[model samples]
Target chain A: MKRIILSGYIFLFISFVISAQGFKVKAGGNQTFYFEDKGGRNQATFFSTTPLEDINGTANGIGGSVTFDVANFAKSLKGTITIQVASMNSGIELRNRHLQSPNWLDAAKYPEISFQIKSVTELKQIADNRLGFKILGDFTLHGVTKEVTADADVTYLDESEQTQKRAPGDLLGVRAKFSINLSEYGVDNAVIGNKVSEKIEVGVNLVGSNKK
Target chain B: MNRNQKKILTAVVIIIAISFIVWIIFGGEIFTKTQVLVEKKDELFPDMITKEWRNKFIWGLDLTGMVSFLSVIIGGFFYFRLRDKKHK
Candidate 1:
């Protein structure tokens, strides 16, 4: 039993070390922005319709593969990004709370928004330590999934200049922008057709590290 | 199978009937008005209302579901009350 336990510990440690070569991601708070036009959305609950302010929300609860090096993060990586809906904040206290309510996105039932990369295309080296590409994936929101393509620009930082001292390897900075149609994801509404833009613009930035 | 079982089942049906009648008179109107309000509101704040809104109105499936829920609670309440009276 003692020998078996020792062997188990060794196996776990070895696997951890091996997997360290792959990048782990820490999405910074306010780094992921989900923007919506707020002008027309207020008339649903209020009678007087002075256009409300634009709705800008941030969710820090983002995760999934940050793995990759210049040769790997995009080319060799099959990454998934998951965002917890309950963690989203729209700046307005009541609106922020309501965004997760059953009346809106029903975060209690559909608690997550996720994207899974199916393919990466148009990879080109823009300059030294910089690459530009497009990523196609299935973006699932409010229990609906739709294929989307995001334009991505990756900038490679020096291997030794690591901000997250807890992790090993080089840092790859990624900025990806994409557009999603709310109606396409079963999130249609009267205002969405008119006041709010049918398409929601999303932006994400993260520093990925290739741990070795 | 026994007297208690039969009595409880009948009480449950009665409670369900009462709930449906009440829904028709009061909850029914509230549900309808809410539906209209939601639609009107959607005209301005279309993105504010959710997809769940449509099916929860008076003539919708969720209204029927609410009736079922009300039936169970009314049934349980009457059963327990009758049992307590008998004991007393």
Candidate 2:
């Protein structure tokens, strides 16, 4: 009876240790995650509020890869997140066409909007496996490149049966938000401030896997 | 009303009716949207994906332009009617 109770205690202790393991224990030092999902579940969204109208738009052509050093997250993190201009959709077909036309984003000329991550700062550990930080990056839009900072939250999930259902390897979930001024990006639309606000808020939510 | 006057009136009424119908069909939005953003929950993750645009009926170029186009057409007709009456 004493041996049985001791075995039970050993099992409980092992379970507690396993469950308490953090991102550092699961992800180790350096891990690179590719921000490509098979279901095209990655998303980038923009919102513009003006006196005349409020506009909401989304683009799903998100593709990129981030190499995150779990040990040196603030300095060694780097990646680029991209959105295809043609994938931008506003609710109206005519409006979408107009947006992609030369007067607006001109998808034909500049095909992509990208943010290249330079560094992470102000890192805050939100949970055992989650982090919040400010990311400084170069935001390129409408053929113009500008340095921008975005607030981001990242969560690391170790490979498990639950996570395997979504992808093959360990997963990193990133949610970042920032705002941009259209004029600064050379997007000189006449409807700015009327139909569309000059500054638009952008959000990105993506899940990346460390698998190939 | 005279025949020309009657014709212009009928044209105006038709244009108004068409405009009202289009407005009702398009959710009666005061200003048309250029694009729509769609968000859906991921099945496994605590995140959202921008799904394909739905609510197709709520989209189009600014209906204000359509109303203006119809007004210009009616204006041309009214101008011709006035010219004809003057000649007579």
Candidate 3:
């Protein structure tokens, strides 16, 4: 028992040396992983000449991103988001396949869709521990990239209760909404008119943690 | 009317009647089901394409097929009707 206790003290000592590096991940380390809840949908039909039959398709796939220090959202920020194009289902298998086809999205040519944030252009305090920000970045899709900005709301969390058991962390939960015109990014397929809305709407919710 | 005109008129009436029947039986379901061209909004196509656009393309194909099919059915009905009358 004495020997085991001695090794535990040594492990704790090792953890302290790495604490300054980033968010605590494991015990004594400043890193944590979050699985997020996101996406909402409204049902609509297509094929009618009337625009009402069109589906909004607002929420499609789920993805994740990494960031450090939840406090940074109160200022400037940077992050990268990744979403698998192949994994998304629009409720039909063949439709999903065709959607990923070369004539369409070409998921094989570009397997992952992503966004890299260059900076946060605006940050405003909405309420206690809540904030709203506009993040500017290059949004890439189907091998095309364009400057896009997303409006996001973040709620910061206190992690002091778990510090004794885990890493000292600043955790933040966020939901962002954005819109883009597909043609602006050169995704203009003349054949698929009216069925797909040219203006695409997207929303993202994720939780990120960093070293306190 | 000449026999040729009569035959053509019969074919037209037959086509319209059959089309109405099919519509009554299957129109609600076939037309109502949202058969959209599923395109990924997340991934941009090189050109402008949309689910509704694809839906219309498919819808057009289906419509063309139905029209052609009705023509053949009604034309055969008329030809057989005339052939049986000639033999009599």
Every model's DockQ, to 2 decimals? 0.01, 0.46, 0.03
- How does model 3 do on interface RMSD, in angstroms? 13.7
Poorest stretch of ten by lDDT in candidate 2 chain A: A16-25
Least well predicted 10-residue stretch by lDDT in candidate 3 chain A = A41-50
lDDT of 1: 0.56
> lDDT tens string, model 2, B4-87?
766776777677677777777777676665433455776555644545565544533357567758776876678566654543
Per-residue C-alpha lDDT of model 1 across residues A1-212, encoded as one tens digit per residue: 99999999999988754443322333321122121212212110111111333444555565565444433444564667777787665444565576677656789899988888887777666655666789899999889999999987766545453334523444555567788777788775442335555557776655545543
Q: Whose TM-score is greatest here?
A: 2
Residues A1-212, candidate 2: write the lDDT tens digits. Answer: 99999999999987755443235546687899998666767878888886756777788788989986775677779889899889887676777899998889999999999999998777776787787889999999999999999999888888999889888999888899999998899998875434677789999989999996
TM-score per model (chain B):
0.37, 0.57, 0.36
Report the lDDT of model 1 for residue B25: 59
Question: Residue A51 CA error for candidate 3 (Å)?
Answer: 5.4
Ranking by lDDT: 2, 1, 3
Candidate with better TM-score, 2 vs 3: 2
Q: Give the interface RMSD values of the models in order.
A: 16.0, 3.7, 13.7
Instruction: Count clashing residue pairs in model 3.
Output: 23
Model 1, docking class: incorrect
Steric collisions counted per model: 7, 4, 23
